[model samples]
Target: MRKIYVIGIGAGDPDHLTLQAAKAIGRTNVFFLIDKGEAKQSLVDLRERIIRAYSHPHKRIVEGRDPDRDRTPADYTGTIADWRHRRSQVFEELISEHLREDEIGAFLVWGDPSLYDSTIAILDEILERGEATFEYEVIPGISSVSALAAKHRVGLNRVGQPFQITTGRRLAEGWPEGVDDVVVMLDAQQAFTAHPEAEIYWGAYVSTEDELLASGRVADVAEEIVKTRAEARERHGWIMDTYLLRRRPTTDD
Candidate 1:
């Protein structure tokens, strides 16, 4: 039997790599890094830099490409299912080719794998289909939300108050009801505009050398965020950003 370690690399910063994560990298016999095409080269480069910094002498690096999805399709769920299946296939192929008995293979995930990442899920699906079998372990890392909160010097949730974490798509479709604070990620649509009345603490390229930080009333800064995000994405060729929104308390409430 083989062992597979799914380690979180944190949010784009080398410093965020936990000691355990570094140790995992060193111990693993094979490392698999996913490439999502040129639009996300920064991610690939960051992973490579981390591997070079911490990997053991004998560890093999295997680069894998995730399959592209057809965005023209009207069926969103179907598209995602197909994409996931393709991604699983790619990973399964890599694991089959490189996995050795009693040797550990690892995948370095961005941020925490337990968060929005689907890598573990896809791997599980492959196992369910009986395509692969390996003992798996997930090592958590500091999430973007934690980094964002630290940068802003604000608690994610008020004392005794609950908060929610959601994607940009959900914010755009409809703001979740009754949440005081919401952490939003994967925001390509400038979803802050949907919640014009909330206060926002936004950061782009967070924890990186070229980080951009902005905070203000959402309505007041939505346009600025849109413009800044566009410029940053163009300048850097890639950007990974996260933000927090707090619905301001009304005088009546």
Candidate 2:
């Protein structure tokens, strides 16, 4: 059977690769890469470094052009569904054309595959379509959630409080019903600014050479983060950032 390994390579740093993920890289015959474009080529470069240092010379690299989607759209679910369909089509084609029945293929993902990343969802679409017959396994790597917490030297949760993980879009809708400790990812707007009373631990380009980190009461640091984010985005042509927001525990306990 043709086998596929969807490996998580971590957030922006080659060193974030787990040994298990590296071993999977060495075993893969064809590595399928989704090119997200030149602006975010720093990510592709990190993946390349890991692949170069570990994979055997006989291994191959296959590039799949990532389909573009509206970053902010009124029809969020519809936009994503259409985009995922296109991505599944591209991935299915790549797997069918280059992956032989007995050989293995791999997709190196940023952070953990189970996070906000879409490779797993796209692969599920490919499977449901029955265009490619392959066995696959997921290798989890350190997610930005963990990296962010580490960089900020803080735990995700307070004493007995639970933590919430969500996207900036969800955050804009207002805080989740019952959580005071929240980790927000893919937040272009620094949504934490809306809840300035909360303390925030924010980081950008995490674990990379251009890494930037800030922590303080949201009201105190929100403007600085916005400015830093703009400057970093202009300098690198892209930005990947996440933040944790923690408020005083309420009686919901």
lDDT against the true structure, each candidate: 0.88, 0.90
List ranges where model 1 is wrong by over 4 Å: 71-73, 250-253
Best by lDDT: 2
Supply candidate 2's per-residue lDDT for 102.
97
Q: Write the per-residue lDDT of candidate 2 for residues 4-40, one digit (tens) a residue.
A: 9999988877888999998999999999888989998
Q: What is the C-alpha RMSD of each candidate to the true structure, in Å?
A: 1.8, 1.1
Where in model 2 is the C-alpha error above 4 Å? none
Native-structure RMSD, model 2? 1.1
